[model samples]
Target: MKITQTRDIRAANRWEIMHQVLEHSPISRVEICRRTGLNKATVSTIVKEWIDKGLLAETELGKSGGGRKPILLQPLHQAGAAVALEIDISQVQAILTDLSGERVLAREQFPTLGESFPQVYHKVCQALDKLLAEMPPSPYGLVGIGVAVHGVVDLSGMIRFIPRLGWRNIDLRSLLEERYHVPVSLDNDGNLAALAQQNLEQASLGPEGQGSEALPQSLAVVNVGDSISTGLITNGEVFRGFHGFANAIGHHTINLDEPVQCSCGKYGCWEQYCSNGAVIAYANTVLPQPISTLEELITLIRHQDPLARQVMDRFLTYLAVGLTNIIFIFDCQAIAISSELLSALPYYLPEVMRKMVLPITHVEKVVLSRLGKSGAILGAASQAVFQFFQDTAHAMEPGQ
Candidate 1:
């Protein structure tokens, strides 16, 4: 028991040291010790171990504070890589990123609308094959693959259901892992988007303010695409509730009089009124000509068409209603709306705020998501890199 405890502690220390280096490289051993509160000996020993393991590299000397110029350290980013995939109802997009989650290759994608699981699977595999072939040479090669699916994903990575695609009980993780021979993480698109947004917020803090305490302890991300879903971050962690379905706020009923039913078998759900599809559908009903896409609706609104303006006004009203409910329930530090249409219109936010019956403080908390459509994609890649470090840490023992 004592031996095992010692090993666990050692592994934890290694993880901490490595995390600090990855976040603030090229950082010095002395700076790491100062920031992490780890002793000089522990930091130096772990740094040496990682350097010897080919995961870390010592770079040029940093600026001198006083006596001696300290040698800076950086992660060997090319030592490993991760693949991130975003499985949308209409398409599948994939990107290759380094150990630091930096893009290593151009984005690859293929359409998957109305395709069967087998067809989608084959296309995904082909895309992966092309990506792998073009991957730069590395020591660890592909460390893991992270997938973002729009649906209810369980703790074990089982996709319980995807309402948009009619996919149910798919073990995508196991299938991908079996074929690729690497770790596969499957998560809800909203959850992954929230994760990516949180990381971006943390990174914006810079080195001195990069820790969790410096950022909001609770935040929420509302993803508005074909449908509406939400991701919550509580105490600086993704809040996947007991059943891994905590933040499915799209299904939350916001209207009782509406006749339209949601995919989840409910009337007047939030998504039915506030999603991009909802906006376009409503626009088509009110406009002279039918509009099939959000882009068309946006163009009409840009031209100051009276019907388009009316549709957007109603959309904003419903959007504010749902957002107000979210704020009342979660009381997050900030609520980020991830939508192409919403982000494109700078005036929509103020309009939404005007419609919401909330205090000035609450109104200030609402803002647009900086990540846009790439949130889930980048989140998947970051998750893979995170898992790799975690596994690497736990695998460390007394010696090789």
Candidate 2:
């Protein structure tokens, strides 16, 4: 066995070195040693192994003070690939990405509404097969696949519930793994989106000398689409409590006294009030005429229609209540709101903040998701990328 693969601690250190390269590539061996707190000799030895494994490649030489210039190392972008699928109520989105998280192949999106779980699963598998067939031959082939489910996915990969689509207790991970013979990861959409956001933020931090600042250690991503869900990220890791059900903030009670029914059969659930569906439901009651979409409602608000304004105010109030609850519970550095509605009504962020009981400084921390519709799918893809890194840690293990 190679020296770097012998000890578990050394394997972990090697993984960290590769991780730094993946995040901030075209980096020098000296800088990698500095960032990872490893000796120069150890870094050199591990880099040799990775280069031989074709997982990493040395770039052009860097300037030197007196001796030979240092060789910059980066992830071998074409060595392997990852596939990510995001299953939503109406459609599924898929992408094939490289080790550096760059989309190597064209993405695919198809309808899923009114389709059975088996049908949706078949489409997902087909999508993966098609992408794989398109990829140019590489040493590592396909590393793994990650799926972002728009519902509660248990730790065992069983999808417990997705009320909007009427899905319940589906073992999606096993179904795919059994057929494809590839590693599979299943997670809730909110959590995966949050993970994607976290990775994007981290990747934005440029090379060692660049002045890019790091993201906050703790944050929450609240997605208010047809449904509502929150993903809590703490210290760069997702906090999936008890059966991977953490941050199901949608079902939390917000109006116990005058409870409104939710599709989940819950009373006064936050989702029933703050989701886009909830906003439409509330709008229908107050508007002179019923409107089904957020764009129409926003257009009415822009025209200064008093009734539309009233519904907007109520929606903001309920949303603010939910935001406050999230802040109090997580005490995170920031809360990122993801919704087509937020994009429609970006100007009302201040109004929503004003409704919050917290100080203006704290309330100002709420921000809209920068990722938009791509967050969940990209996040799902990131999971496969993460697994690749873990496997890379032990790439030199006997018969690995």
Candidate 3:
């Protein structure tokens, strides 16, 4: 809980004090002093300002000896609200959470529109409108919208590239700004998923994972749906390399000698062999039947069909090889597989774990994400939450 002042204080250090209280609330002035190293007088000044601003409230008195009550303080849950949005070619998911990443409200999902970018953007705005109509009116408007896309993106809302959606050089941020008239943060979905895992498991991660040993300094989140790839976190920060192009493990050539066309304009990429599409293709090759969704394939695998088992086995093998490289390269604390894919892994992770050790002996704990399919949106929202709490000095500007 200890927080060091990272920058020059402004606005009476309002955001910093509010952030610390939000993180370690129901805490006394003494504890706040100890955690933040801010003098008792300065802490008093900030706490009073927050209380007056309707941003924090005093709870029970403290028990620092039999003295006058040192009132406990916590953030006002309604001081502000943030919107998180997930988008792709197929569907868009949204959630509104408070500063603590807790959903104080409901979630919304809607089908994506036609091929036109403007159409899909309108659909998203409509979805937000619908969700907002259902909420109880409050003074705090939406803090900002955090958008998660499927391509490379800078902090600006530009869609640098997304082949599935055929979006390139699209000014998505500016478009959203025109709609919401508020700040907008944009990032790729994979990184958002990684943020979701970190936020959802914060109590169980960092230097404090559930087990005896401390959490690893690195993590890799792999989403196995229409696409196969990874998002990496190291030392508690997303690692986007020189050009914001990192952790595209799906394009890693797993089948180097066996050439096949890949979605990323490559040959023999791993996604061609390990994605859900690959699983469906393998099943169709053996069973000669059409399959519509990945969920159906899971049902077949659960039933122990030979074709399902055969495809799953190969899929797990290739997945482990790529994940093994991730393990070796980053030596992460844990690997989080999406919940949609974990069910099949229950029937296969034992074998995957066994094979993962085929190349390396030190086994990192591999776990299934607890957030389900909503992870990307939740993750994107968490980015907003963190951004909202961070001191201004650390806050990267809209286009930075």
Candidate 4:
């Protein structure tokens, strides 16, 4: 009867819905229908399948409808729990997020400097224990942990070099695995930032949304801090050039001023013009007194210090000159900014766009990251999960 026909339509609709839900769960069937343009009967059928498969659980019971109650669906932690760890020179931050990237608990932050590798590792374990104590048990359990830090980490988890952290060739992956007894993933901080933004919003960079799909996918993740770099994502992956030397735009030779030396043993790398270090350097020259941080400059700007104003304008101009080539080359639909710099995007974003040679319509596409540091941790976590999934997918064959 009508029930059988409803099921058929719903079955097909559910498949479509699940694909979308895999990326964005915790949504109501109503939103799913609007997103996929399907009827309620179809949504219900698919939701039931997801519910039966244990991939979803009921989060809320809405008011009684025309017949039955409305239930809000959330993706179960089927893909399992993931631990995201960011190792900074000054602090370490960790978070545990479900498959859908919803942080299930409060993040744990710890000091990083002067601690032995074993000591720092154990503190992370203790933090995980504290977070899991209040949660209900799940089926998939903890699948993996992702760690991101400054430096070169080979696929093997060896930290080749981290100048800021003052570490060289440390065996980080093996050490973490020994303690956590879970799969560990390590990536550069910039790469993780790009992954975080990708999950938050689809880039209009490609043809399906903004331009031609035939073009190679691309990303520019500008992170401003004590250390800075842009992580490039291309063709649905991080474009680590032969030997992983891509996206080091921070050292692209953007300046030639004297007494300006980059850590890479060069004069006027892009970092000298667009990084926090650059701002601080300029603030000292312009103002009667040197400013310690970007926050101090912001405050100075508010007080109408002519020095702050000039420095801000100069930063914007340099950033513009650096990114214009990005648009021409990557044809990037979005240029994501992360870390503490995101909060200041509203102030300097327009100026950054104005400096571009392109039209206002094109420049208006400058995209700021939706998630801040949260993206960094989650990006690492997602990397671990995807790596696991790929391995699993490869191991299973259709005939087998």
Candidate 5:
């Protein structure tokens, strides 16, 4: 038991050291020790082991502190790579990124409209094959694959349902692991987007001494596209709830009098009123030419068309209502919205804020997502990279 405990402690130390290096590369071992609260001896030993293992590389000298310049350490980011995929109703997009989440190859995508599950699976496999073929030489090769699905994904990586695609009970993780021979992570697209946004905000905080304000401990990411979904971060971690179905905020009933039924067979779901499809559907009713895409409605609004503006105002109002409800339930310090329509017309953000009236909830805390459409894709890659490090740390156990 003592031996096992010692090994676990060592493995945790190694993870801590590696995490510091990965997040703030070109850092000195002394700084790592300070940041991780590990002794100089332990930090030095682990750093030496990783350097010898080709996981870390000593780079040029850092600034001197009234002494010899300290050698900086950086992760060999290309030592491994991860594949991230976003499977949406209309499209499937994939990207291969290094351990640091830097894109190693151009993005690949294929439309999935009306495609069967088997067909989509085959195309996803083909996309992965193409990416692997183009991957640069690496020590660890492909470390893992992360998938973002537009549906309810349980903690065990089982996709429970995807209303848009009519998919149910798919074990995507096992299938990918069987074929790729690597760790596989499957999660809801909204949850992954929230993870990505959180990482971005944390990264922006910079090194320890930059004096940037700390990120909000609680945050929410709302992804409004074909449908509306929400990712919640509570106390600085993704809140998956009991069944990992916490992201189904879109299905929440917002209007009791709504005559039109939502895809989930509900009346006046939050998504039915706030999603991009909802905006387009409403626009087609009043516009003479019947816009099929959100872009068309946005263009009409940009041109100051009265009908388009009316539709947009209604959309924003409904959006605010849902957001107000979210704030009431979660009390998040901030809310980030991921929507192409919102990102394109940022001026409307204030209008959304204006419509939301709650004394306890500060509407000003609501903001547009900086990651935008790439949130889920990058988040998926980030998840894989994180899992890679965790697995690597666990491999430090004795006899394995």
Candidate 6:
């Protein structure tokens, strides 16, 4: 039977309060109420419930100026864990984390490319087994699992397509749920990365951080590797389009006259000009020697090799063009670039900024992702943690 889910306003409020406590621990109920705009009674009720559930704990008493010493609330580390797994181009990785997204254990294994889905699936299972075995005792044991797929995922938790991985129409969610017996969250890598980026930003801009009040509520996270894809986070949540493909900028046409074909069966797509693979491919076309890695190309550029400089100039120009288009379309508060190329952003950002349509403002919104490659994995685990907190039964369960 299909079960349609609806939100519980109380639960959402509880989540908000719980997140505030997690981010700013040792916080008083009055402060929580003030920050969340929740009534004192409501905050107290939720805090009591969390404490009863062993998900929150009361720390030392507050300062003496208060009438009665107010007890501070903090997230309980042993509440439960969330597992995150990712199926990338050549690897399967699993990570286990507690309620606050702190890593407890991790496992990774390389699955031979071009292998059958089942073979790759088996490899993922092995990594998960190892991760689970290494987890410590906790009240909530593996409450949720989040899977990150390197492709498009549908609402039904099916991997619809992944040309790079040769995966199509695979029911990965069902396969894992049947074996692991936990709520599973599935999303594309780019979307997960965006979530992680947002989480990172929030953490860094906590209540104590200077200018925390001025942080943006929306962002555009771009991943530029084998393919250029983007993920949009607006109003503190992901913005999935009708087809759950809002950020397929890689397939956007940037050069109509170009002859090269993209994996998406399109000519002169944005990725063809801006992706790391595209850079190497373009380098191969101009340089007599093939540039196998970005590091090699960067090294050549550092030495001012005429051929390397020419290829890099073109790559940067194309990257600037693509980024310019993104700025015009999203107009988001920030555009964070996520890739190994992030290290090089310092060198090329000025050029990219100069090419943008908008005038440079005092706000430095364009930057690099702090989480880097780990963003996707962290985001996956965070999704599971989100589900865990949202589950009324699980979140309210008292300690056994």
TM-score per candidate, in order? 0.93, 0.90, 0.85, 0.73, 0.95, 0.89
Clashing pairs in 1: none
Weakest ten-residue segment in model 1 by summed lDDT: 205-214
Give RMSD to native, each candidate.
2.5, 3.2, 4.5, 7.5, 2.0, 3.6
Write model 1 residue lDDT over 1-400, tens digit each, in one string: 3535777888888998998887678889988888889999999999998898899999999989699899999999889889999898789998988888856575689998788888999999999988898888999999999999877888777888777778889999999999999999899989999999888887676656655546777888988887777899999788888989876788899989978778777898988888777787777789999988888888988999888889988988988899888888887778889877787786888898889887644733778888898888888998898888878887766563
Q: Candidate 3: list runs displaced more than 4 Å.
A: 1-7, 10-17, 24-26, 61-70, 155-157, 205-213, 344-347, 357-363, 390-400
Q: Which candidate is the best by TM-score?
A: 5
TM-score of 1: 0.93
Instruction: Report residue 84 deviation for candidate 4 (angstroms).
Output: 0.3
Q: For candidate 2, write residues 129-187 as lDDT tens digits.
A: 88888877888878888998888888787899997788999988888778777788889
Q: Where's the lowest-lDDT run of ten residues in candidate 5?
A: 205-214
Over 186-302, each residue of candidate 3 has an lDDT whose tens digit, in order, gives: 887778898777655554522212445565568888877666657899987888777776756777787768666775777777778777667778768776577766777788878
**Models sorted by TM-score, best on top:** 5, 1, 2, 6, 3, 4
Superposed Cα deviation of residue 121, candidate 1 (Å): 1.5
Which ten contiguous residues of candidate 3 have the minimum total lDDT?
Answer: 391-400
Q: Per-residue lDDT for 1-400 in model 6, tens only?
A: 3434333456667788887876677788987887889999989888888888888898898775647888888888677888898787656778888877756565665765678898888888888888888778898888889988777777667898776677889998889999999999999878888988877776666444435545577788888876667888889878888878776777888899988677777798888887777788889999888978999888887888999988877877777778777777777778888767546545766666666666653334787787777778788988888777778433453441
Across residues 227-254, which tens digit of lDDT does each residue of candidate 5 receive? 7789999876889889989898999999
Q: Which whole-number lDDT from 0 to 100 does residue 47 have in model 2?
A: 89
The number of residue pairs in model 5 that clash at the backbone is 0
> Against the true structure, candidate 4 has what lDDT?
0.67
Q: Scored by CA lDDT, what does every candidate get?
A: 0.85, 0.81, 0.70, 0.67, 0.87, 0.78
Q: Could you tell me the TM-score of candidate 5?
A: 0.95
Q: 246-266 in candidate 4: lDDT tens per residue?
A: 555667776666575676667
Name the best candidate (by lDDT): 5
Question: Residue pairs in steric clash, candidate 4?
Answer: 207-211
